[model samples]
Target: MTHSDTDTLRAIQHTERERFIASHPRSMALARDAQQHYLFGVPLHWMRDWPSPATLFVAQAQGATLTCADGVGYADFCLGDTGAMFGHSPPALAHAIGEQAARGLTCMLPATNAAVVGGLLSKTFGLPMWQMALSASDANRFVLRWARAITARPQLLVFDGCYHGAVDDTLVDMDPLTGGTLPRASVLGQVHNHAAFTRVVPFNDLPALETALKQGDVACLLAEPALTNFGLVPPDTGFWEQARALCREHGALFVCDETHTVSTALGGYARAHRLDPDFMVVGKAVAGGLPCAVYGFTHDMAERMVQAKNAAPEGHSGIGTTLAGNALTLAVLQASLEHLHTAANYAKMLDLASVLEQGLRDRIAASGRPWTVTRLGARMELQFMSHTPRNAQDVRDHAQSELEAFTHLFMLNRGVLLTPFHSMMLVSPATTLNDVAQLLAVFDELLAALRALPARPATAPASRSA
Candidate 1:
């Protein structure tokens, strides 16, 4: 890039920094070179969340912090979007990985830890059988396929604005007119018509769910106990009982994706709340920041699911990955189950999250701002609106982008970090009280600054009231 172009980019970035500044020269310089090789300027497109010029290229992460290229250290509340929710490179997880590297990696064979982990899962989730996958998305896909086969049903049901990690069956959206899935306009290049195979209903609406289920073609109801991606919309009281009852009446399997909400308790929100889903998926931090994800089924369901699959023409089912259930991963899972993710760890995390959420909520109220913080397990989010949202659309309608960017940058600039996405924050056992206080202090400052800003302009395209 020419000096003039570089200077122009810098000028635009200067304007952005005037608007958002989590960067300090070094991050910008690094971003310039990175854009030449990597797409969207940073290694990952989503890393753009750090600040105006670019994301602070991370040098290393230890415990609950980020060491950036600019030599600034930040308290990392993002925690790799819960991928490192147990705290980055935890000792037990690391030791297990190193030990397992020597013990041999992948084989179609099961490690002795497999049975132990299975029992642990059964104890934690109240589900008797467990299956491993490389990611929560993959596990969800396999679960849906199993559901389809066992029930011999063609239609799948997911909540509106629910995210199940890129599985095709779960991608179908609500048709604006028919109010049913319609090869979702956003769905692209799919060989199979997902609309024909999927249905979406407003969450927490038992009548809506029952109406759809009445068709009798629904295979499974895939959902997060709490919606995270579409902003953390928790279900209304007793919503689960009503929804589960509807599914039972409809003969649809209930698959709860506790990938994010599992941080709620050792068994996940489902077990904690006594909601008995046919299958439960807990991922992201299950193996203590390693690449492991799992799904569990009740004993009867597991037997039937396996039989249904075996009764099919055999080949790779496109379900399991080569490195999934590898020795290193299993060892990590074993160590994680034994040393981390314990009852004590969960209690600590949930308590810290409660503190953080209360602090933010108090600060928001003190600022006289229209915002509220909500918590589910160890995950808590501060939605930028006065009134709480009831559903995804309500949350989306009230989202405040400028306010979110401002708050995120404000936190980064002050040495506290939060998730890049506007939706959430994660708390791990390793997160300290001082660290939580730091975040609250930063948030207090951001809300104060936002209060100083002039009235929202009619031209402001982004919603900041989320």
Candidate 2:
């Protein structure tokens, strides 16, 4: 490692802290205004990630931009972290949802649209049978339960740093003190031992994964198509093929949670990559911002799941929700399948992602900084490390809070908004080349500002934590 690079980054962080505090008058005023009613001065706890005394209140948003309470607008590349990746209020979805809301929001009965939507899912994702839930978390929980019941296995395997939307078993990790995941105390109010059902392994490590499933107790391996939550760690070359082989060998189901990765193709990354998952869970953008998630199972697994469900007496099987597959959700899903999830939308988003990726790469390179960018179709993120990380620890270890604050705040001030927590941004179909150009201009300025700083001490000043 070169000494000069470290010095430059330190200097950048020093100036960033001071510069960030000095500006943000509008954001500061709004934060003070909001602290009166909301806990942690924000509605949701995580909104504090953006650079402000409190979270910036969003007034109005459309397509790829948001107007804050202070009346400043941002080229919103975050897109609600893929929930709005279909583009906020796309005309067809909005019209259909509005009509459905007027007709009926949720009825206990199934709608004809459900069959149509199911058919579309079958065509797009190659799954023979389908089920509905409120979110990806529910789908994962359902998948785990069904897998266990069908296989009569008691355990599951998951990769470290993989987030499947608050599924209970996924909460296990390398212990803070012991480095082996037992029941973690940080998971407040969780009464059961999650470690009893879960085995956590590092990504791209086949030996580790095989070891976990070799016991033949893991019912399934729940994972993202490519781990995106740990800041876009693409699977190592040949990682997926080996992982698939091991699952076959170990009698564990391969469940791909494409909740965040549905942006990659008309179906998802799974279909695009020819991943023949026994079960698939996707949410976030499927129903055009509605609280709906759906899952599909292969024909063989579908029969088993049906039999397992039929064996259970009706009323609270722990897998069904009243609001799931409601008339409104079905209508919205049908509309989204007809409009948003089309080939044209995928093409548009992919083109925009390429532009954003190229711009970030060029800007980062010009600054002479040792950082990298990762792209997963419409989703792109800039990570402050020279190379992509291999596992959860690598990602956490390489995290640079001061630099992240600097980058996010700098972008916020200049009318561009990235996702609050990390350098992640999703290019929506509504996003334009002009928005991309403006972001590049602003990012260029921020990089130049960082470059101008004289190297400071290695220790960076304290700031907000992610």
Residue-by-residue lDDT tens digits, candidate 2, 31-125: 88878998878887778767543466778888888887777888988888788998888889889988998888887989877778889889877
Please provide the root mean square deviation of candidate 2 (C-alpha atoms, Å).
Answer: 3.3
Question: What's model 1's TM-score?
Answer: 0.91
- Candidate 2 least-lDDT 10 residues: 455-464
Candidate 1, residues 91-192, lDDT tens digits: the string is 988888888888888888988788887887787678888899989989999888888889999888998877788688887666646777755455558888
Best model per lDDT: 2
Give candidate 1's whole-model lDDT: 0.79
lDDT of each: 0.79, 0.81
lDDT of candidate model 2 versus the reference: 0.81
lDDT of 1 at 421: 68
- What residue pairs clash in candidate 2, if any at all? none
- TM-scores of the candidates are 0.91, 0.91
